[model samples]
Target: MRQKARDLFEKLGYRKIMMAGMLLTGIILYGFLLDSVQSDTYDIQLFQLSQETIRSEKTVEDPVKTELERQRLTEEVAPSYQFMSEIVDNQTALVASIFGYILEVKAPPEQEEDRLTKEEMIEKLREDLRLLETSDNGLRLTDDMLSSLLSLSEARLLNVQKELNNLLESSLNESIRVEEVARYRTEIEQEIRRNETIPNDIIQAAVTIGRFGIIANEVVNEELTAKQVEQIRNSVEPTRILQGQVLVQEGQVIDREVYRQLELAGMTEERLNYKPLLGLFIFVIIAVGLLFIVISRSKKDDEHKITEMLVVMVATSISLILMKLLSAISNNFDLVISFFFPTALAGMLVCLLVNERAAVYVTIFVSAAAGLMLPSGYSATLQVDVAFYILFGGLTAIYLIDRVGGRGRLLHISLAVAFANALFVAFYLLLGQTQYSWSEIAFYFSAAVVSGLLSGALAIGFLPFFESAFGMLSTMRLIELSNPNHPLLKKILMETPGTYHHSLMVANLADASCEAIGANGLLARVGCYYHDIGKTKYPQFFIENQVNIENPHDRLPPEKSRDIILAHGIQGAQMLKKHKMPKEIIDVAAQHHGTSLLKFFYYKAKETNPDVDENTYRYEGPKPQTKEIAIISIADSLEAAVRSMKEPTSEKIKKLVDSIVEDKLKDGQFEECDISLKELKKVKEVMCDTLNGIFHSRIEYPKETN
Candidate 1:
């Protein structure tokens, strides 16, 4: 029954987990908030009633403005007169501002013309310079003497000529006049002289050129003034625009006022009011049913549906309860605050335990639940405002956080949550003209901490419950157990050092293999670490993992040797169960060896006793059921088998890993599971790489040093 439940959970989707969390969170948060709200309401109501009673006693003795005071009290409770409703609505409006339709800017006409003309001028100058430089170089100006002489200014050139004349007079016995050669040299010098004729048009044009232009048009909302709209338009405009060009399209918010637009999008007090209980119930049903569909619809197997639903629902419920406890505690304290509490908490979890896409939907569910569970002026109006905060907070958290592995980085995660919530609340307050103080900022910072801590706390507290209730073991718990400091792991290291070292090597190989195949690398690595833990019972039975071995297995009969080898899987599974390890780990340890033949033991038995049955030498059966387990099983064998090679080369390691994988495949070891052939090939490649690393050459110990 437990195995069945686990299998179902393994197949459950993000939606189911989220729905369960939402429902649980809603129930707890709602129960608590409703109680708190009711308690406060009762106090306020009792106070008002007491005042009325006092006035009645006064009126019975003598008449005054007692009736007027009663009327005033009634007015205070009126729906339109309630101040909190407006605050919540305004908050919603501010949150709505975070979303706006983006208009991509097109190229402006003036910028385009300017850019083209500049390019044309640069091209022309480049061509002209190339021709003059090329001609000057071809006239033997490559020589340093001639090149240096040509580089001088016109006056400097004449000084050089005078110097050359003096040199010729000093060196010669008689006067020499080569007029043609001198004339040619003079003409060449004039050609090489700088031309100052070109205008500074290029620099002028480059400086004057404008890149683009835009005309923003506020189309959807009219609450903003024409001047405000013009400001938005001007802000969006590209620096240069062609004459009569419409830079902005009609009915567009040229400069976006997100808060006002969000208000216009029905986040106002009038639009928020609804039958609170009915709205909450209906929304929950739609959300739950939709979530169920996303998670369960993809599967066609009838045998698994009931079990899957139960596990998913149970896992989700535990998560939700944790979220509620954290939220309730945070809300109760003046030190705790966040605009979107449960939503952010759920976002990080969805990323850790599930995929990002699932986290998104889960966040939505939590947001809606939060709306139903927060305090409001009019119960109906309050729900809507709360929903906005919840949705925006959840979506924003997930959107901002894209990757998952920063789980232990609490401070960093808290800062992220704080900034998000601050922006959310600040935007609302500023746009809605909501009042705030330094205390509010402090509250927001506290809320961010609460949000991040809640996520971590929930994962830690609920992990065990979910593992038990749903039989769904997670990667997190596996990693915790794989640590060398763990009691079981430490025992293995101290008592069975060879096995422990072997396990670590196998873990590295399996981890890399699983990642290459797009499987859970951590799960693979951790599973590998514990896959042979059964050998700890009789440490000297296995060769590589044995220390001071006197060939215990060799001394035993072939049949006995096979039995001992096969018994390790069962032994490992029993040990894990006794230690209360998660079922996933137990499966990895028990099933990793599968029912493959113990070739050495079987052949030895056959040689000694011709009538011996090969079946008696086989392992108890249950093949790899997932990619992580499958990769670990292969890694365990490959790591052991690779060490047998005397001079292991890259090519030999590749063949060895491939042969092991092919043998496993041919024997149908992966038939019952979802391990794909492509993944298997990747695993083979990783094993080869790891083997090379392990066997890489290092300096041998020197006898002199010893």
Candidate 2:
């Protein structure tokens, strides 16, 4: 039982081990919620009026008349006429009986007593004149006589008046009398009126009739007479009407029916399912175990095991708790809130003390809890939208963040959040039916801006907690220490100025080397600042603080000298841990030497005591895990090695950098932590470039030479 407990304890104690499981569970849970939310759909209803307002409803009480009687009424009422109804088709039908008529210019036959057709009068007169000519009865009818003779009826009376008026104004005696022309016109008009005919009302009845019948096969002719055209136009215009408007009356049952239909459509049955929840929980546990296995094998050197594991758990718990609490408050209060609560806080804390992967894991878990807790709304599926926003925003924050030990770095993280939120909201608006009211638009903008500000603020608030609990030295802390005004740094400066200057130079070289190889330059520089902190224990033993005194190693045996020299790495790690520095900084202090040989002490000890083991003189190490640590190891060697040159030249600097890297590679100092040969080559180049800068030749001044 004790052994099992110890094994479990070991599992949780490793920082990387816990993160492996936490992140996988978080993402899987988020995906589950996303799928579940889609099951529920909302109900909706739209209303409009019924279609029955166009056609006329006629009654049997209205009598139908014979064709003869209709024609008599038509002629007696107003004269020459045409009748029609309105238009209709498949989409709209006539609702009521309405009709209209078009009248010609002249009055009807009964009312017009003086009109005649030209052919009628011409035929009658033609016969009379032919008979008279054949009989040789030369009768001279004078204009006055013809005018009096034309006055037979009201039509003839008008003809006689025209002749009298025209004859008086003419110059020639044989000029045609106006009475004859008038009489001819009156005869033609009467004949035309008397011969007036009516056609079938097939075309008129079809107008505005919809759905009840098919459209007629015949197309109306383009050359239709003016009367025919007028009839068709009047037929259609007044016949059709729309029935889409609502009319509420005391007896109408439609209101109640519409209400019932709307309620039925509005019902929705979307709720949480338990099987998925339990399945996700199981997945989380399994994932945790797998992650433990991957990272456990990676931790070859088991130093500060308890401390590393505790850091992972505490950070994870605090970040998760804060996220959950904030999500709930944001929902309850109806306030704008980020899906990723305190993003920068989570990101900076994870990056500073733990690996970047661990930080990413923390982000994923926080986003998962948000998916479960976000509130629902008519226009929103908060579960999915929030989870995606948090997931993507956190990912962007992690990708862009740099540990430059400046507030400006937070701005870049904020910019990334803004860009990610804009993209997500734009996609949702364009693709989905999620309505964007003014309030919703304002809410989105406020959420994005507040997310940025809150991330920065929370990072500031939570940083000290992680720092104090883990005994971690963040880049920020190291930067503060490197300042000359720092109390400890000032003491080192006033008491032992040489060590202070040496540390500064090492910081520069390490920073440059790390940057060249695409490693964390800020971390490298900061680590260098604190790497030799163990020397403060026995300041005189270190070469930098020795002042002008005799070497401490000169009086000691090789074994003792080797022990003192190698113990500093362990001592530095212990001091940092005691002062509550982060394990990453502690790691740099412990692993920078990487168990490399102490050549002078080892050779001297072999000469003095031939039976002595060479391993006893070596530095203890879990070889550098990250590129920053690897570069720091190289910089430590380069700085010390190059300083020994009295008159350093560019070629010497290059050879020193090359030889140091090659020897470390051959010694297998970089065998662990996944450092590649390509990285070593890069480290060499960086060291060479930095060394060249430090030892560049300067021209002599003429005054100085004199």
Candidate 3:
């Protein structure tokens, strides 16, 4: 029944199968993405007191509260200050110079005629002091003040100038800002009054002049102050509402804070948003389109192309559906179960059933789909971390399984996958700075490990089904079929020993030749094993099976003999189909001889009857349509031809193999297949090498030994 169904699928052809796979993939993906896209929003007016209080549906960070707390902390930090000692030094020097000038003018000079009058000296001093008033120092001593200092006797003037300079220097020594200059001036005034050596009027005038010299030396450091505020803001921990935390009771009225929390938790209804669904549709289209383009451009046969499309679609769909199911369960229990989704299962299956490149492409598409389907904290869009997690896990599985030899290596691959999952989970937790307790960390780590092991286990479980359903000639299946214990192989060995030996020789030649030309050597060898199974039904009719008997064809007419010989191809294909073998191997049995004429039988008929039809001796064939089948055809013929050589020297064997391949080429047997001339030449050379090794000269043993 299964064989009949497989045959029916083969008859449906590639285009229909590919379309069905595409439609099924789109449906599965769209259903999951639609569920994710529907945001759960509450229908409540902004700022309006609610009749019924709304609690958070899921745990989320209160962005509004977190921001407010950070802002308040930042405002509480004090502005930083920097001291500028240079301003104090410049102002004090100006005061000392003004006082010294006054004393110098009051003193008697050796050249009395050159000395200026008091008023003239005062005018000159006013000019020098004019520039000081306009300076940043803010020093503006009046002309009257200068005249008052000059009017005093020279000794009293020096004493008053010394007193004023001492007061200004002491006041300017401390760090004073622009706002505190008045207080420093007041302190200096009291100090000057304490000095009774000069008159009270001199002390008052001196105090006023010293006050003008004082300026703010300390300034606000804007850059440093901003940095300090930023640090304070960052130090304040973010206030998060834990998952499943209730914001308000059912009967409690909705306040401003409760309303904001509902919005943050995505409980505020604003109608169902379909934008995510639309985006997901576009995403699916692009992913499917890319796969289509790659498959169309590749050199695979129609069956293989169909198989590839089916595997890709089915694997991606299964992975995403699993993610969605896990997400739904996690949402119910408030668990972060997205990490435990076996995202790498699809990638491992793809790598096993298809090529590595296709597996990589499938991994990327599956990761992106997972990001959308998985529950991200409060956002409806794709989660970047989930995407990274899936990508890391999937690629790791691909890399590990790519080097695997068979199903036996899957356990090791699973272990490697677990390590990769754990590493990525640790990295993600560390990057997000998530504070998980030892128990929580262990739970997450264990989940990740389970995800990896489950991915491998699921892949192993599904592999055989896919290989059987899609008729995929996977390496594992090929290896299984190549075993001698297979029923058909056992039958061939028991019933037709000569044909069995011939099939083995053909398998060896085909395997070596296919490998040399970069074809599927295993498929070729396995196909060759069952290529002549039809001979077992009529053991004595074929030459290989007629070991001690006369030629069966000599007793029958040439036309009847040709019919018996040509029936093997079709009969062998039917027998394989009965056993439900892969389509590729069955194709080898059906199309190995192609439509090439049986020249010996045709010539024998022509000699007996002058007008024998040539088509009667030709085998019915669709021709070899793949490189593997084409190489098998050539290898099968060459093996039989080389075995029949009476004098099987290296030179004779080489010549026979070359002649057979050339004759098949002339008959256009390889025209329909994709075997290039260069590959064919390599195949010929490999065959000659293998044949030479088998038929190489051996040393003669000494007669005396008998």
Show model 3 residue runs off by greater than 4 Å: 1-297, 332-345, 360-472, 578-580
Which digits, one per residue and each the tens of the lDDT, describe model 2 over residues 1-706?
A: 4356458657666455455445654564445444433322222223434222211111111112233344444344322322112222211221111010101111244545555443434344444444333432222333332223332344433332233223222211222233343343343333323322211221121211111122222333334544554554444322211121122222333354443422222222244556555755665565455435433543324433344444555555565566546645764554445433544456556655555676676567556555554543322223666667667777777776654544435666676676776677666557767567888777766666667666766665666766765455555555665566755566666755666777778889888766776666777777777787777767788787786799989999987877788888899899888876656778888999998989998888888688878788788887887777877888888888787788898888888888988898899888776567887787777777777887888898778563
Task: Give the clash count for model 1.
Answer: 8
The CA lDDT at 364 in model 3 is: 90
The alpha-carbon deviation from the true structure for residue 137 of candidate 3, after best TM-score superposition, in angstroms, is 14
Against the correct fold, how does model 2 do in TM-score?
Answer: 0.52
lDDT of 1: 0.54
RMSD of each: 32.5, 18.4, 7.6
Predicted candidate 1 versus true structure: per-residue lDDT over 508-618, tens digit per residue: 998898778767787777777777788888888888765565788767887677777899889989988999887777898988878778889888878878888877877
Question: Candidates' lDDT values, in order?
Answer: 0.54, 0.56, 0.80
**Candidate 1 structure, TM-score to reference:** 0.55
- Candidate 2 off by > 4 Å: 1-264, 268-377, 382-453, 464-495, 606-612, 622-626, 703-706
lDDT of 3 by residue, 1-706 (tens): 5577558678987788777777777776677677676656667765555655444544567777888998888878877889987876677677777777777766677896988987798887877777776776556566677777777887777677677777777777788987998899888877877877768656556877777777777888999999998898888877887654666665566777787777776677665545666787887788777888766765677766766887888888788778867787875754477888886898889887887788889889888877777875655567887888888888988887746656767877788878888998898778876588888788879988998889889988998889877767677677778889889999999999998999899999999998897788888999999999988778899888887789888989988888888998999999999998888888999999999999989999899898988887898998888898898889888888887888698778778878988998999999999899899889888999998898888899878864
From the highest lDDT down, the ranking of the candidates is 3, 2, 1
Q: What is the TM-score of candidate 3?
A: 0.70
Q: TM-score of every model?
A: 0.55, 0.52, 0.70
